[model samples]
Target: MTEAAELPPAPQQAEAVFGDRFPEAVRYGELLADAGVRRGLIGPREVPRLWERHLLNCAVLSEAVPEGVSVCDVGSGAGLPGIPLALVRPDLRITLLEPLLRRTNFLEEVVELLGLDHVMVVRGRAEEVLGKLPPVHVVTARAVAPLDRLAGWGVPLLRPYGEMLALKGDTAEEELKGARAALSKLGVVESSVFHVGEGVVDPPSTVVRVEVGESPGGVRFAAKRAKAARTGRARRRR
Candidate 1:
């Protein structure tokens, strides 16, 4: 396993990862890396990990996103998978949904700095924002939430037959077990897990793809909101 201390700085490695062909992607990564450094979002020693572990890990989602499709990235802190995907596939329209004011501000600045016209940022929680937006062909997340909860949040915004691409670590099996009940309740029937970057230095990761069906109605929405609000309040109090 690559220690966080041994990782390359985000800017240098991101440039190497994107190469010359994708100028915009490279610029976006550079800007985000700089911002991360300024905000102390990641430790200096962890720079290399940001590239191999964070950026490249997120970029792998590109293979699963179909061509000329719309994607929504929930809880898109610093626009990891979404920005990288948008950079690679200009054809795919990406909406980054981030509730935190600070992160959204940073993402908007990064988008402008990179001149990414294909992306948009939404400032609200997924549960509140998913209903208002058009159904997207794909929904993606990285370390945002657990499998079942993420599916519940994602399914409502997904077009029928649309898929959820969730990035997970080695504990994927345990998470899947815990999420089974929640998955069934959300109408996500077929779920499969794929291992990616097996030979890489970092611990292997998995992509759990869940097929979304119709969303639960208004009552369910309200209940979810109430629970989320209570959880947030608790966290704040703590």
Candidate 2:
């Protein structure tokens, strides 16, 4: 096997972004460089720029999240925004949701090693967990899928008035424009594109924020939720 590339030192901005959890951030970076590459969760080429492109890029997402809210990171491959967000914000409860077993295993280990009591690793696709997992205040994703398709998976898992934050690149605005109709169908009352990280990271991270109203996943999801509630009531009676 090829040797893993060296993880670059955390940029000076990381200290300010991660605050007291800076050490944990460094440890996470090391793991991403080492184990993350070995397991094919992340490419070896990504190791050298892990801090600037990955960690800090995701960590600054915390600025867009509300205080003391629950968040689910969909398709949390290698736990990008979820783990980094957890490192910075202890107050926010985070669930790292990944469909693959190998990736979930890595996330579980990282959570344990970091002692991130606030973070949970769940293995399942976003559609599969819709009714099984409680809806959260916010759903986060990065490089998962197209904006419309991704909204279909992430929006239904949110509580009323919750938002879906997607970390995109230059195509953020373009995707939002293309997905506007799909977003409307998913009960997205408002949608926009914005950037985070500013001085913390050059160019900053572009994000597509999709906010839902009272009916988070639209009409069909409401019916599904009602059915699930009834099923739960029946089970309780049994």
Candidate 3:
């Protein structure tokens, strides 16, 4: 078998970004470089730039998140923004949602090893877990899908007046523009494109922010949540 790729040192900016949790961040980087690549969760080529492209890139997303809120990271394959965000912002409760069991196992291990009690791992698609999981104040994603389709999965999991922070690349604005109608249908009241990690990272990470009003996930999802709540109450009484 070939040798495992080495994890690069964390950039100086990482300490400032992750604050007191810098050591945990380094461990997470190590895990991604070794186990993450071996497990095929991330490519070996990504190891050299793991700290910059993955950890730091995702940790900076904490700037856009609110002071204290619940966040759901949809399609959280290797816990990009979820784990990093948890490291930086312990004030926020995070749920890393991944459909694949292998990925979920990785996430649960990371959460446990890193002592990220504020973070939880759930194995299921966003749509499938809609009623089972409580709606969150924010949903974060990275390289998951196109803006329109990602919104379909992420938006419905949000609570009223919550927002989705998607980490996109140069195509952020273009995708936001193209997804206008779909966002509207998903109860997205406002949407825009912005950048985070300004001087910390080279070009900065582009983000597509989609905000929803009272009825998140639209009319159908509202009905589903209501029914789920009723079912839970009946089960408790039984």
Q: TM-score for each prediction?
A: 0.79, 0.91, 0.91
User: Model 2: per-residue lDDT, tens digit, 1-238?
Assistant: 6566677878888999999999999999998888888888898888878999999999999999999999999999999889999999999999999999999999999999999999999999887787799989999999999998898889988999999999999988899999998888788999988999989888899999999998765537555755797899999999
Q: Positional deviation of 11 in candidate 3, in angstroms?
A: 1.4
Best by lDDT: 2
lDDT of 1 by residue, 117-216 (tens): 9999999987777557887889999988888777777767777778888998887878888887777666676788886555432555578888865553
In model 2, the worst 10-residue window by lDDT is 217-226
Ranking by TM-score: 2, 3, 1
Report, for all candidates in order, the number of backbone clashes. 4, 0, 0
> By lDDT, is 1 or 2 better?
2
Quote the positional error of residue 202 for candidate 1 in Å: 5.3
